[model samples]
Target: MNRQAQAVILLLLGGAVLRASVTDQYLNYVKPGLRGFLIAAAVLLLLTGAAALWQGMRTGSPAPDGHDHDHDHEHGHADDEDGHGHHSPRVAWLLLLPALGLLLVAPPALGSYAAGRTGTALTAPSDFAPLPAGDPVRIGLLDYASRAIFDQGRSLGDRRVQLTGFVMPGPDGTTILTRMIVSCCAADARPIKVALGGDLPPGIAGDPNEEQWFEVVGVYDARTVKDPVNAESIPYLRVVEAKAVATPAEQYES
Candidate 1:
């Protein structure tokens, strides 16, 4: 690409990155901790592109063959006559496609469509303490799963709990409460989920494809359910109440 085109592409990509980072939209695809890095990268790109643009305007465009006409070609080696010696490779131009896509139509974050494709269970560590006093203790999906599956539900101990996640359909005609755990970005996101033991009301079970978010108040059921396909331990929750809720500002948990 020519200097002008390269500069424009850089500015656009930097703008897109800044927009995503400033508005908290970056959380949809990446961990919350990456905010600083994204912002730094955007600033650097903008500065570099602005500098290149200024230089391009001052120096004018290159020759059709990408050679500097003002240079002393007469004294140069015979092999330099082809003009291809200093030209950039054509493959570098392909980098513009991602920038254009980001500017025109950004892709949505991974959701139910992604969760259904992968069936690996997420396990938590075994260092949890007893549940504090609360009718319903708000806890993360991954933490609950870890205690339930790995620690054998000792920490839960009859305490009511609350979890928020989207609906994921199970192979046995059941619906699961599911959330994706993102370490750095969407590419590394993995699903953590639990099976709702009792019958779900008509409203909450209405549309599995919609990927509706919900806050479920329930207690852990000691009875462990096993994934027949993978033989992984699946956590279970006995639902006391279920309410439809707005999707959280940050879709994925760290």
Candidate 2:
């Protein structure tokens, strides 16, 4: 392809690279440590693309072969087999196909895929110490659970509270427990086993999946502690509402 064509291609891809780099959509999909690699790759691609554009424009200059010089190389293969001539750098713009694909079909946000995956708990060890002095704090079941099991003891003792999460597997498949687990950008969040306390909303019901989202209504009730795992150590929030909803990409990245 010609240099102008290559420049157009590279310009489009560079825009995508810049977008993916600045936005949470791509970075949140990656694991904590891996995000840097994608950024570096985008940078390298952008730079190399700029260089390729410069070379493509210079195509107007004479070539040693004295034949029409191929400007853009196809997908990095500078020459065809048997040393045959190739399409100009304009063809290299074809590389943008994959970039376009990724931008459109970006993988679904990590969502609730991370139910029960064990790893570092978010709570600090000091949290287990006697509960901090606060009137009422909104907290997650998993956070309370981890605290009960490992952190120091604290009591909610009739505190007004709010909780949110997805509907998780309960005693029977028909009866669901709503929950939310925040694991590294919600991509691997664990369920917080919230207690339902009120009427249901149209949007908040269903089987939990990797991409589903939910919000719940309820208060923290002391008697609701029945969970065998960490029941004694963790606090429970009594939920009054369960609503299913679609979260914007930015909303889920947290």
Candidate 3:
């Protein structure tokens, strides 16, 4: 509540932002393109906090009468009322809690838990081009979904495709491959889901633990199912191979 406390809060918040921006942690909360802005904002906050703290310390010196004097009469009155110069309510300290948590341990990106609750976001119908030349061409989950659902899997053909996403359990004991799509940040993120069918690869048994990342190799299946949450048709993939994979640096698709 005091000038020093306010400045410390700013510094803590600034440090937390800087830490998230400099590392891969920022990807969990925002798009990759916003990293520069986040870094710039953090630097500005740090500078402002440093300047305010220095100014507060410089102006807090005692007068000859053993009473603190401030440059402004309003501040002096506030100091008189609180005795310790605290100018705001004590509840403001609560803002520091999130800052401290961010600095200590950044939260993980949205995964199966979010995917299960959110309905699949299907893009507007558009003509999709043919898959690139590869035995197992890599494809984004949203793109594949669009091709399967709207285009009726014409672009997909018989080529095997590879998709990388976290696992989400679907209705009727089905498995789902999911990725979050975001225009700006995680607050507006929506799930893009594809149901997985067929047998699992060797050494991988049973349904994967929720939220575990995986790279699945499969071909398009004509089967579509209704989403329990939104009743939207979710396309299917007949998986031929699958393996656990590390989470990517940027988890969300733009």
Candidate 4:
């Protein structure tokens, strides 16, 4: 690898980062709050690449004959082994692989496949509060699970809750409403799910594994049992109504 190759790699990485940030695809992999940092990083990389390319192109004048040439010659061997050689480490070239994947494949966000493979736990707020007034109270799946398990569904008392998440097929031939919670990125995402019982609405009934997004209006079943896979209390919901919905731009819950 030469200076030009290094510069190109930097530019490719920078461009990919910028594109992800600008196009809102960064939300798929990481949080929205990282957009500014991603942009700044991309800009820095682009500048570094441009500087390298400029320096490489400045061959109009030869170096003055001096001890400087001899000094470089003496240290050339040392530099070569330390990544300052005409041929850089072969591993450095692999950096462009992610850029290529991002550009060409544009991988989809983590979906039901990832959720199904991981066991989940409910995360409740330290200070629980009553649901805001609404015909069908909209609540997060994690919050609901926590309330059902820890609070004995006291806060949920006869309230029809509305929840949104993708479908995760259960072993008992039931569909689960699942959401992935991420503190940073998809790599650390963990699934939080609620078992959907009673009759499901029309659109979701056709295929349990369809991985469709849905908004369900239901009340907590209040039947408590330890979840076999995760060893935590599984929250059950008696589905009163459900409807297919579009996947949100940001799929993961914080």
* Model 2 lDDT, residue 46, Cα: 78
Judging by lDDT against the true structure, name the best candidate.
Answer: 3
Q: For candidate 3, write residues 1-254 as lDDT tens digits.
A: 77878999999999999999999999999999999999999999899999999988988877678767564564768778977655899899998987988988788888888888889989856578778888899989998999999988988998899999888778777788889999999999999989898996532335668777889999999998888989898999999999999889999988
lDDT of 4 by residue, 1-254 (tens): 66678888888888888898899688889977878898999999999999987775553224686345534653485477775644556888898898897777778788888876678767666767879999898988988898888888888999999999998666555677888888888888888888888788765554674578999999989765454577766678999999888888888888
For candidate 1, write residues 83-160 as lDDT tens digits.
554334578778777666666777777788887777646756638877767789998888898888888788898889
Local accuracy by lDDT, each model: 0.78, 0.50, 0.87, 0.80
Q: Going through the candidates in order, what is the number of backbone clashes in each?
A: 0, 24, 0, 0
Instruction: Report the lDDT tens digits of candidate 2 across residue range 1-254.
Output: 54556666666676676677667666545544556776777777678778877776675555687754443334235455435444453456668796686677665544333433322233554434343454345455455555434432344444444444444443223223434434454446544544343455543334444244565545444433344433322334455555566664443222
Order of candidate numbers by TM-score, starting with the best: 3, 4, 1, 2
Off by over 4 Å in 4: 59-86, 224-228
Residue 132 of model 1 has an lDDT of 63
Clashing pairs in model 4? none
Greater TM-score among 2 and 3 belongs to 3
Best by the TM-score measure: 3
lDDT of 4 at 42: 92
Report the C-alpha displacement of residue 160, candidate 2, in angstroms.
3.1
The lowest-lDDT stretch of 10 consecutive residues in candidate 1 is 70-79
